[model samples]
Target: MNKKTLLFTALLVFGILQSGYTPPEEGMFPLSELHKLDLKKAGLKIDQKEIYNPNGTSLVDALVNVGGCTGSFISNEGLIITNHHCAFSAVQLASTPENDYLNKGLVAKSKEEEIEAKGLTCRITDSYEDVSNRVLGAVAQITDPSSRLQLINNTMKNIVNEAEQKDPTIKAEVSEMFIGKTYVLFRYKTILDVRLVYVPNRQIGEFGGETDNWVWPRHTGDFSFMRAYVSKDGKPTKYSKDNVPYTPKKFLKVNANGTDEEDFVFILGYPGRTFRHRPSEFITYQQKFVLPYTSELYDFQNQTMENAGKKDKRIEIKLATRIKRNANVMKNYRGKLQGLRGIDLIGQKKQEDAALAEFINNNVAEKAKYGNLMKDIDELYKVINGDANRDLWLSQIYNSTSLLAVSRNINNFKTALDAQPAAQKQGFFDQNINQVKQALSNSYSSFELDVDKTILKRMLNDAAAFSPQQKVNAVNKITSKGSNSAALIDQFIKHTFELSKLKNQDYVLNILLKNPKSISAYQDALLQLEQDLNKQIAALKPEKDRREGLLNKLMGDYVNVKEKFLKKDFIPDANSTLRLTYGYVRGYWPADATYMKPYTTIKGIIEKGATGNPDFGYPETIKTLWNAKDFGPFAKKDLNDVPVSFLYNMDTTGGNSGSPIMNANGELIGVNFDRAYGATINDYAWNESYSRSIGVDIRYVLWVATKIDKADFLIKEIGIKL
Candidate 1:
């Protein structure tokens, strides 16, 4: 509204239009590419080298891949800070009815009290190098699309294998930055001895719950702490009592002073996949098929689990994490559907693609190189869209339940064991059966009969209603055997559970592991159904692989043509790799006559908590502290309340959760958590206006850790006293 601000905004837009280049907000720029941007001009107070210096240690080394999500080492002792949701499974694993660490917050007073986070691993990026020439060069002579893809895969594997062989402590991965265009080899330092340091209760971490998830003006804390450990010699190793806290080469310092609106910020972490560069055909499929299928199915699953949980406390605890994850994704898909429809991203992509096609055809040289690109891509999509419905439904079967997932895995073990030579059969089992047991143990630990029965029943119903051409044979077998569909489903469930004997952990671990062949004698109805579905899936794999191969081969050309038409540097889409996305802390109107501020405070939590909604649940101590005006050093002078979370126009996606969003001075100001609901479209497209990312402000994190959780020791450990 101010004259100076209005003039600056106008000029910025004009410059962007004139240059035909991307703004800083649109792409998750890789660490290697940070130097290409004018960081200081963007209000970055520190040298770009401080963020990522190829020749020496820098802030990039502090970033962590906490499994699927991102985190950062905040202390020399490998104290990692990440989102509560990222550590959901770990907390759930440690929680039980009598000792509910989830409901009641946890803090380790000393290293002795820290509990092992089973199966959790924290990976710190050691370094990354471009391997495009080596990967693509090896497959240049291959003419067949399938053969070329195979060779590319083999070459990438060889590169990773060689890297890991050189250093056994490192875990290496070759990520394709662009399909058939570029590749990067990232080597990571792994820590298996990860342990929980501090975890806020559900009321704090998940404030506003699913009701406010992905919505802006958010007040969710959405943060937790864990630490990584290694052997005494500073080498990566699994959990052991003798292990010591792993000293990181670099770590981020907390900026408890926090930030305000219009402040420049950037985030470095592993962002999940994005399809912004994909052609219209891909966007259309995502909009019409993938999004709908996943959202609706997840909605049904969450509802089923919720209903079951309401009846049994045990079932509630067992399925809590699964439901939370499913519901989060379900709502996110629904938001994407809203964004795609509301913003017309699909329509926008179609227009851009049309222009690209025109550009390709207008020039003789370009036409010769890409004449059939558009048509070939359309044809490929046509085939995919034909079976989109059936294929989507079929893909969900393996992931439908823990039981089915285990069944498929163990079944593979059985198949492999049976295929070995008679002399080597026992040897094979001796080598592989333990792996099967470990997999089954994880599945069986979380397995619940009620939840699986409900999901299975729903899956069968979906399959039964499919078109005649897309019929699921397993469902058909039962439907044909009986006239009443309900009766058949019931009978199938009854016999499957009773006959399988797999519900018994002893039987599954002992008898099944010893002789997988014995499982078939039971002739379980559900197992038989799974076998039938596997056969169908097996029959479909080759055609699927062929289509995928062709698409992969063509996409490189597609990207090349688009770049030529635009005459701009093409930012590669996110693929769960380390990337840096930057922008200012800003706000925008989500709708007509409605503007959302960039920041929220503890006062918002109080107002939402009073609404009697479970999602906005809060502990009584928070109200007590606020009522008494026991504001410590954390309160903001202007607002007279601690800032809870702030919004920024940075490109982020699923795996960016728990990433440290840094201030201009390269200090941790907040932990990136969610995006505005409208910004869910960020995975497909981005704009500075609506594509805002949210972070739990470090001030709120400090206040909660100190006053509420009584974690003064952590305050001291992090070297920030408040």
Candidate 2:
């Protein structure tokens, strides 16, 4: 009962909390809790230490955080496997009309043929340490919530800065595993140069497109391969022709035998975020506002991109990645919205919240400490919900995928440059000029003026229609009441783009070299608009900070009291940290009278493609190979064909995409990609019956790699000899 002890050690000792429950729940269990679970009893043929040995490298050493998604090393030469979509941006960036790697797919047989994945970096977890005491202790004497939160943030940043300064190739992040309750500092080996090694054509990689995305009983070959490289001297550096492949401490062995129904399976990867520990008020806000709003917003952006892509092949290629990304999240949000309602999450949570209240009231000291906690949280969310519309609109306008979003960023930088005193301004410019150039470089590489104008106009029109209470002043300034504001928005957008120097990167950089007054005076319609709206946006921030700070402090104490009241500590929520979640390879009834099998095969792919819908279409080579029955050892005898994908009830979220699913002996069975649509509600609550994740079978991966794509070297490199 030593509450002050480190969370990792405490949770390990307590063995998953409740008196009756010795095993952790069906969710992402942190590394420390791994020893408590009986892997052998759960059909694991190998010792648990093989997956994660904190004292040294284990299977966890092979895992890589590829951009936002996860990947794993499968070859001693750092041949990494991940989701195709995870590598889609890099492919898109490298593709050109003359040599369109995306459309035809890139199969770099030799190291010299590998293309640099622009701006794509891979990070491996080096180590982590608990820093909760230091973080919370720094704010102990501060009574003001805002100041307390500020001090806590500063402490975390200082810790990360200190850890990072020790080595140039290592960066550290302080994750708040349980908001206010637990914090851990994770250090990662930063590999800056990653290269795209192999990928199937768009037809095979994104087989069903949005139609089959996030749905179960799927046959999408959503997998790809990449490689990590370092300087010849074994040091990470920027992409260079002289670089060599990285040799990992551990790599997963590809077991194409695949898994049978009810076989034990586990996944170790970085899951992004979850809110299972959130209050009913938070659930209510997500159900009512966040999901629906984001779904519609992303849908609109997808439609806009589709409309633009219809013009040409080059444009289509350029827009493909954006469309896939927007539509993927767009559909996911819609599914989550349906799930949130299906579960009646808000109602269920309220009941538990009431029980919590009753529990607090029953105890004298608990009542004194947590009497106003629920009420305070509810009030905080009330303010947040009320302003959600205004904030959402502003967020879109200032942070869209268009160049105008870049303009807002550059404009803000310029404004900050202008605000500095004349003496200090030169130093500020010298320090931040590279940041400005980097933003321009990243955004303008894919900038489109027509797209920006259309997106900005629509965003403004939407903002102009806000209710009187939430009216946007900057939007209202250009349009009159009782009239069509569409024309006004278009006009404003036209003028802004015409006058914005943000488009002229060289000109802006030259302007930045001058005095602070020069930077201010060089402003145009776009910068001025951002400035006006930011005044309103900035004005709202203090209140948000005050409310958020209070919640942070209160939630910390609330977790302790709640743990005490429940007589068990709830498993921690996912916060983009490494975790292990396991479940058997079994199917579930998606609905009444509908039982989904755990596996999908290549026949399903050809069957669906026969319909002739573009999404279902695949390369003719696949059909020819299937017709000829040209298969290899990867084929399952019972299925009489290669298994395409399978579903398991593994608890996962967005960042888990590209995670390698392992069999009992830690052999790679598949790469975890999508979750069943029913599992969309997983962020708020995970019902074991509904939370099933889909993965591309390792058999299918080698089948396509060896048979169709003729990547024989890959088979030899992985040592499978398929």
Task: Provide the overall lDDT of each model, using Cα atoms, as 2-decimal numbers.
Answer: 0.86, 0.84
Tell me the tens digit of each residue's lDDT in model 1 across 560-644.
Answer: 8888888987889899889998888877878888878778998999999889888888988888888887768888776899899
Stretch of 10 with least lDDT, candidate 2: 1-10
- For model 2 the TM-score comes to 0.93
Q: Model 1 compared with the native: what TM-score?
A: 0.96
Clash pairs, candidate 1, are: none
Per-residue alpha-carbon lDDT of candidate 2 for residues 1-722, written as tens digits (9 for 90 to 100): 12332453354335535334333346798886778778776667887888889887799999999989999999999899999989999999899888898878999989999999987999999988999999988988897888888888899999999999986668899999888778899999989899999999888888998889989778888999999999999888999999999999999999878887767799999999999988899888888888888888878877777787787777777777777887888888899988988888899989988999999888889889888888888888888888889877877675564566665677777778878887898899779877777876777665666766777777888888888889898888888653778887877778778877677766765664355566656756776677778789788877767877888987887778878978987778998889899887867888898888888888898999889788898988888888888878877886798899998888999899999999999999999999999998888888777889999998998999998899999889998854
Residue-level lDDT for 379 in candidate 1: 95
Q: What C-alpha lDDT does candidate 2 achieve relative to the native structure?
A: 0.84
Error of 1 at 613 (Å): 1.0
